[model samples]
Target chain A: MRIGFIGFGEVGYEMSKGFLTEDPQAQFFVYDPLYEKEETQQRAKKTHATLFSDPQSVAKETLDVLFVAVPAPFAEDAWRSIWSELNEETLHVDLTTASAQVKQRLGEDMLNEKRTFIDGAIMGALKVYQHKVPIMVSGTGSTSLIDWGKSTHMNLTYAGDLPGDATNIKFIRSIFTKGLSALLHEVMQAADKLALDDIILDSITRTMDKEPFEQIINRLISSNVIHSQRREKEMENVIDFLNSHGIEPQMTKATRDKLKMITQANILEKNQGDPPKDWKQVMRLVNCT
Target chain B: MRIGFIGFGEVGYEMSKGFLTEDPQAQFFVYDPLYEKEETQQRAKKTHATLFSDPQSVAKETLDVLFVAVPAPFAEDAWRSIWSELNEETLHVDLTTASAQVKQRLGEDMLNEKRTFIDGAIMGALKVYQHKVPIMVSGTGSTSLIDWGKSTHMNLTYAGDLPGDATNIKFIRSIFTKGLSALLHEVMQAADKLALDDIILDSITRTMDKEPFEQIINRLISSNVIHSQRREKEMENVIDFLNSHGIEPQMTKATRDKLKMITQANILEKNQGDPPKDWKQVMRLVNCT
Candidate 1:
């Protein structure tokens, strides 16, 4: 099987190496602006692959699979440049962090052109997971790639038939992971100032470990109405404290606003003293407010 | 030792119940507005404890320990109302989510009045951990509480000698826990909308279980400089996508801003292609920017 890679950057390079490890005899074509670098040249030589100067040339090959692992900002341009070179049989997989809407547009365009396009959103650190990294794919033509991926021991899931379903899942997941990491960073600063980062981290780990994610969400949402007022008041003080400390407190402010909004919505009024049974109900209440 | 609880609220009730379980002969005096409630009255009778109508009465009992478990906003007021009633030897322990400033002010006031004040910040769900829940304490009066807490099988940590140190630790910790919960709730809504909550939660658990929290933090901070641009672009799209779905995108927007700020700082410029050796260094770079 011949595989072509467009951008030989961090994730793309790691994935290419994984392919070589799985099947050393796999034919390969690569194109990267840094192809002339000693590292890139040596990698290509070891894999018995040809290094093309242009993305178009790499796509010109009638490969079994072509992975487009470019940066998200350049994903659309790269797709358009490779459009003329892809054959109807080539399975084009994109691993960029593009939004679902962007992925959907590309998926529609490729389908109209009688080609297969798979929106493969990779999750986790590429360096750590390597070939075992999880990828969520969604498109009309993702079934074949999913099968191929599983056969090679790749952690791949077929999200849905919608072009951007996989991307949507990835972005939504980011709202938790990246958002948490950013908040943690800000928190670490404040904790460090107090010289209590270790103790605070210990507390965080304890809370996270002691409860299942589902239970935590249910508990927090169900008690939202009962505690919103207290939380809002406390969070206001928190926001002011953080601001005085020279931090912007974006997340803190948002948390305070969300709590206040939930209180204003009066979700408790609907239940007459009982809390919402599900997080979805709470969310609906939030949106309504 | 005679123990008095001034709030007799959710957390106060849990802690008192735990204390009773640990020492069946223990005596308690509780003061709460809901003391007339059948549940509170029954609990007091079951524990063979006294009930008081006012915080002042609870403080006036000449008890060895007095626990002030009021809401954060009222924490200061509760302390002031009880100050005149407390004897010189009474150990005052406050378990509220009050700001560090508020805690410090109360601590100083109590100390000036010739009483020991321990700024104790309880961590975790009172309903879950009960008396075994972790508490971080600060101020000069914390050492005795730590010894007492350990003897009674309560999880306690002496954060530092600073009056507001414990509250500082708690608020910083709250930034991460509350921020993550809010982000998770938003993600859950989006996932529920797509009927992918199960799959996404599975993926989240897998990733979390695959790596230790420390390792995850290190890896993110270390490779941050290299991937900041990609992450910033991806997060920007995430913010837009979340907004399009009617989610307020507070956490998402904060995540995007943090990423952009880090990239703009260009920490890599100082390292000259080398990643930071520790998270503290990364944070320093972020603060510098």
Candidate 2:
């Protein structure tokens, strides 16, 4: 098997290293702007991957798979540089952190008789999962990548048959995960200030882990429509408490504002002062408003 | 047992009803500005509790337990009105959604030799948990409340001996829970807009429930110091994506701003470019700067 990487950064290096573990005889071709750097060269040597000076040089190889692992801004340029030179049968999997729109545009640009374009969104920490990091893929080429992934022990899930579906799911998922990380950071910061970090973390962990996440999500979203007004006031108290302790309540303030927006929507009045049956009902009402 | 509630709202009504199921012989006394309202009258009748005209009347009953469950703004006033009239042996549990500082002030005001002041922070939805809602208590009177709670099956956790410790913990916890709720709301809204609500919810649920919450929290906080810059840029992409879809992106915006703050703190540079071992190290570095 022959594989090519358009950008040899952390992700490219880690993925190449992981792939080598599965197929020792598989040949690797790589091109990177930083190919001359000591670190990049060292990484290349560690994986025993042959390096090319440019994307076009790497693309000329008869590769089974081509992974574009550049930064989001550089993703399009790198793909374009190698597009015409690549074998039509080679699977082109984009693994950049680009927006779904950008991925969709790339997918459209790759449309042709035999070329396959897979929008691959890495959904886990590459440092931990390496090449086996959960990658959600969509687009015309997702099936080929999934089939290949099965043999190579790659963690790949087909999101849909649309070009940017995988990236869309990932970006939407980030709305919750990234927000949660920030929220926890602020909570822990306040806990640290109060010397209650251990206790607070324990309490939060128990509360979150006590129930299935679906139930928690349901309860929170359902009650939000009815209780947003009261919750908005409660958040004011929280903001006051955090501010008094010299912690800027950025996330908390956003929470309060969001709650305030819900309250102002008068969802309770619209629902006759009753909680929605579940999050879906609330979402339905919210979208209508 | 004689119990009094200074506010005869949902919490007071539900708690009284719950206590009746546990101890039907327990007498209930209640007072609220809405005592004259038909709903308040109906609630009082159902709970078989006597409704008093003012806080003083309820306090003068020489009760075994006195619950002040008014709104946070009215909590201090209600306590002040009833403080002198209440028997010293009565356990005064403040369950208002007040800031920790307000609770602490009330705790300080109730620091008499015989009086027991418990700062009670209700930590669950009353409509669901009712009287059994998890309540965290602190201050001089926490032990007395906890002791009584044992027989009544009240969900009580003693936070600490400090007056406002329970409120502090609850307030800190709100920073996470409320923020999460808002984040989920925004995510689900965007998902609905894309007609991918079910898939997005399933994806988020799976990600969140895959591991113990402690491990998740640790991983996010630890990686944050090292990856905040990258995550910040990712959040920009998220904002653009959300904005393009007509979602407000409030919580996502906050997440991005927070990541920007962490990046600006130069935590990665301070750690010599290595990820922190855990959240504590990140907190330590965060606190120092």
Write candidate 2's Cα lDDT for A1-289 as tens digits: 7889989999999888888889888788998999999998998899988988888988888888999999888988988887679667889999998777888887877776467889998998788878899999999879988998898899998888777888899888888888888998999999998988988989999989999999998988877787788889888878888888888888998999999888887776778877778888788888886
**True lDDT of residue A26, candidate 2:** 78
Q: List the residue pairs that clash in candidate 1.
A: none
User: Compared to the true structure, candidate 2 yields what TM-score?
Assistant: 0.89
Write one digit per residue (lDDT tens) for candidate 1, span B33-144: 7888998888777767799888788887868778988777888888888777887777788888777888888878777777788888887678888889988888867898
For model 2, residues B163-224, the per-residue Cα lDDT tens digits are 78898888888888888889889999998887778889889888888999999989888877
The parts of candidate 2 lying over 4 Å away from their true place are A33-57, A82-88, A125-129, A264-276, B30-60, B127-129, B268-275
- Top model number, TM-score: 2
